[model samples]
Target chain A: MKQQQQAFALPPGAPSIDAMIAAENRRARKRLWTALAFMAPAIGFVAIFLLLPVFFNLYASLTQWAKFSGLNQFAGLANYQRLASNPKFYDATWNTLIWVGVSFVLPATIGLSLAMLVRGVKGEETFKSIFFLPRMFSATAVGVVWYYVYANEGIINSGLRAVGLGDLANRWLYESHLATPAMIVTHIWQQVGLMMVLLLIGLNALPSEPMEAAKVDGASRSQIFRHIVLPLLMPTLIMVTTVSVLAGFTSFDLVWVMGRDFPNRSTLTLSVNQYWESFRAGYWAYGSAIAVVLGVIAMSISWSLGALQHRLDKR
Target chain B: MQKKLSKLLAAVALGVTFTTAAASADPVTVFHDKPFYQSGWDGLTATAKKDGIDLNFSAYATDQFQAYIQSSLMSGDAPQAFTWWNGTKLKEIVDSGQLAPLDDLWAKKIASGEYDASSAAPFTVDGHIYGMPTGLNRWVVLYNKALFEKAGIAKAPATWEELIAAADKLKAAGTTPFNATIQDGWRGFVWFQELLLRTNPEAYAALNQGKLKYTDEPVQNVFKIWTDFYQKGYFTDATSQEEPLDFARGKAGMYLFGDWVIGLVEKGGVKAGTDFGAFIMPNVDPSLPNAVIVEGAPIVITKAGMENPDVVKFTDWYMSENAMNSWATDPGLYAGNLKAKTPNPIIAELAKIAADGKYTSVTRYWEASPSEIVLPAVEEFNRFMTNPSEEQAQKAMANIEAIASQYWASKQ
Candidate 1:
């Protein structure tokens, strides 16, 4: 060992720069393999569970699948044609759009306002915990609670009656014009807490230097937020908005639990309608077509948002 | 060494013997949707054991039960027997070739006068019986007797005019006259069927068979009556608690439901024939024949199950008077077996009404119509019930017709 070291060692008694560079390369290649080895199971699962089923579902949408007729009897876009003619599909699509539009306005706005209000306020953690409490409950449980709140003789009606506004105390979830909006409010009640927590994390992580600089330059609080903080918090905002949009598009549990029997199907988003057709009606192929349509709409919006996120990241 | 090896061999042989015996002792399983009938299932299982047949029973929620049974049948992993709805629903399953015909068993039971021959009609498809009646239920008006007394109604309504007068009295007495709900998404059809069948039973049957359009006059007249009832403030709010709750709590005066609801109503602390009593709804048109809607729940055997001789034997025994008594009598079910009498006073009274009047048995709308149409039609009906204006009724009727026309056109 001493003879080899004497033969190979630099005159300074350390490894040569060339040898160190080669060693660094070897370590990086080993890391690449190790990281891949660690990631292989997750990659395999995504391929099998996620991608495979999506492709199968896509194929199924083109068939004439029914409970009695069974599967694999392809009718070549007949299901889609039927869905196109069906008025309920249009109604569901309209409801989903309304939900998506509301998500863009409600959850994020409310969450951001609460985040900004409680950022450095007294008992901040307590307020945050209180706001985040609804997030801890499952969507179905929230639905059940909210169901009674909007019930005919429930809290809202009782409150209205107590104030001598009995005329205004309508069946909140029974009316077609009110049911979808009522369910959306319920969904947001459960959803905004998560949005608040997420935005709070983003706000807390924000670097203070830009805001300090803006303040010293005589910028107002609103100006600082609009110019410096907002620009810096774009990534989190994008993530939160994207998540909200997807949740809105796929709103099911609340509508199912609360407004499943809404006379006009006023609470039916595309997701709930898809479940109704598939499981309840047993029109499997028609349901698959609806799912495909929903997936396409959600995917396109997400893809556009992702592209915008990528461009912002580059900036 | 030889002795030790022999001991080890004996232990392995003994383990195999026990394993084989355990495997062979597995019970034959039956899946059912009625979770409420635990006592009846227990009694049936006890009786089955006397024939040396070990039976295992499983129950599923009504909403998910059909999907479970259908998927199981398709995958060929279904239990030997399952309870299902008869009529177009059974025909759909029979058409799928998953159900086994029980014609021989039906013939034997009918011949012995244990089961009524006419009861098999709903379960028959293409000249083959595909199911056996778990119970027979006749749709009737189960009224809150206390509410009726408060309204000063001496007896049940025997005519359409008397029914209206009773409704007015009940409404005047500060109660909703009828317990109507779209709860469970299926009860919306109750009032619609009751009105239509009472007016013209033939039209109702034809409407379900798709031979009569929903836009036809008879259907429109039915909706007209339904709308008038709503206008008079006779119905409990559609969003209120489900049946028996509204009916038993005296929130509503009359409940139009099947006789089978006696069990559930009793559970709500209402004594049958005392707090509540049933009446066969009066005909809307005096010239119309006496009719009562029949809802029969049937136990269907899979074709693979029929291959087992023991399952076939068990099925034959299941249709007998003894099995009917074991399963149905205590539960207050209206058993299809003519000889088996239910002990529940309300069911017994309803059964007597049907027998004495010899009412025409019209299939319930839920089971009479094709499922594809019924599922969506119920939603539309609920919509109409919510806003029972003439305009909304027309829209609802048009929507139902759109669905029915499509389904019928496709069949053609």
Candidate 2:
């Protein structure tokens, strides 16, 4: 009697299995169409604003187009060849490499240490906000303010004089050897705040169970952080490094504002070199070549990092 | 069927309305770089209104203006006319074949004796004028008379040796002998150009045209004297503040710059020709002809712009003394029109100097040289200023020559 009742319930008001499967498939297809409809605007925006310009730039790099002049002539690989032989190109590339290396090391160390210190401290929000304050300022404003701080009679020199180190008060931006480091210091000051906030959010999202278990099983704080917290934060760290490296490659405003007045233009990066060549020097094709080189470097680094992240994700 | 017919009628009505609106509102646009010329533009607008033509004037900051003009011209949407530099800089724009020849206007002006052939030379390329010269700026040394007196100098320096002596006296009197600023980067080439022009005017002209090498003797002499001045402390710190401010505060005895800096000096509370005065820089070699570097802004019309009769009318009105008088009086602009009355005394004085015919007028280096050559050369000059050693000077000259050679080779 129970089996008869179960069979009747199972079969009651039910169509054939094929019909039900077809109805579910139709619904799934409708859902997919709706999702695509919603995503159309974003897809269009990326294609128009991002992909089109990149393709156009690639085409421009292959031509001898000056600003305001029509691209009537095509000189395949000529601009890139010129860039390869140009000394300024080499100088800018080396400077960008330094910027990438320092941008990662300094910001990552400062941010990670600050995040760990402020994780559970009293007045945590206040401390976090203070560290995050500089990120709120636009890079241009930061550059202008730091320009004053690095001027010959600016804060740095005045402070040195006040402290009886007057002989050490040299023109910071004027010296080529010191100029890049000076600009890097300003870049780090502006970037550390953002890195800190990102790291803090990453730390908060970390699981408490593993850390607590490690602590309970006779593990030291450093042991738990090394064994559990850092491993968990690896993805965030990689993302932060990738972003910082790209920022280093494309840095312009601070370098332009601070180093424009300097005699040698000693602080010029690849981005600045591109601008000077294109707009100021009116070598649009050569500038495009520099741009393509910069883009290639950025993409290669980002792609390798992404692949690394994917490999780590699989583990 | 009724709804469809009504919709077709509505579409037709809207299209007709838009077409009529577009035809009635075609205004002539003029693009310029100087925001400080608001009063001058206001005067122009009033004249343009009376001609039954609607005028739309747009101004951008210097850098942005250049970029805007470039993009607009490239896109075939350039304005009726725009402000631009004369000489090789204008030649660059003319090379694009976007500019309209103003030979008709030039002939009219020349026949009327309003513009001398020499005045129109800078705007002319290949025997055709592509632009109208509206204003001129003469480069000279503006000095603080009080400081010169305090230093016990009897007269303005007339030779390189005398200038050095005056600089020594000014230094001994505890004043900066010359106010030079490398802060602007372009100023790095100012004194260098002046020295070269004074030493050998022919070589200077040839060098700007890429016909002569930068390592030539005249160029090397300019650097040698510049380095000597630096070593002797005859100039202010290379990294000092702006020249005008320092000169106005009585901190420096002499400043070499364009006549435009007189406005800045006056704004800084120093009276022209009393507390300060100017002189054409003395010739370094007495054997060479005296020359003054003349820079001017030209009004260029585009090919598309020439199609509008109103543009030609406006160009005629702009080149006339009546229109230029307002520019000269309001902004103290020195009109290139010979018939225009000068309002500023210093301008009148410089005009008199220009008219004397003793000193040859040459286009200023910044305007005369190609951008590809001048931009990097200025940077190299800045490097030389920061550390003026013989080795550095050689390297700077070589760098400039290398760039010049590349550009000239490409042209060939």
In terms of TM-score, the best-performing candidate is: 1
Best by DockQ: 1
TM-score of chain B of each: 0.91, 0.88
Q: Could you give the DockQ of candidate 2?
A: 0.55
Candidate 2: TM-score of chain A is 0.87
Residue B270 lDDT in model 2?
Answer: 76
Question: In candidate 2, what are the lDDT values of residues A1-315, reduced to their tens digit?
Answer: 556555755576786566777999999999999999999999899999999988898999999886677586899999999999988898888989999899768888788999999889999899889988988888889988988798888999999999999999988888988999999999988888788889999999988898888878999988888889999999999888888878877889889888877765667898998887777667777888899999999898889989999999999
Error of 1 at A11 (Å): 18
lDDT digits (tens) for residues A162-181 of candidate 1: 99999999888888788888
Cα error, candidate 1, residue B135 (Å): 2.7
Q: For model 2, what is the error of residue B193's alpha carbon versus the real structure, in angstroms, after optimal superposition?
A: 1.2
Q: Write the per-residue lDDT of candidate 1 for residues B1-412, one digit (tens) a residue.
A: 9999999999999999999987876677788888788888888899888867777789987758877876776676877788988888888888777788989888888899776677887787899988888778888898888899989999999998999999999999898998888876778889888888888888988898889999999999998888888888988888775567767778889989888888877777788888888888999778888888889888989888998876877887787777777887454566777787675877776666655657778888999999889887898898887777999999989988988999999899
Error of 1 at A185 (Å): 0.8
Best by lDDT: 1
Listed per model in order, the count of residue pairs whose N, CA or C atoms clash below 3 Å is 0, 0
DockQ of each: 0.58, 0.55
List per-candidate RMSD values in Å.
4.9, 5.7
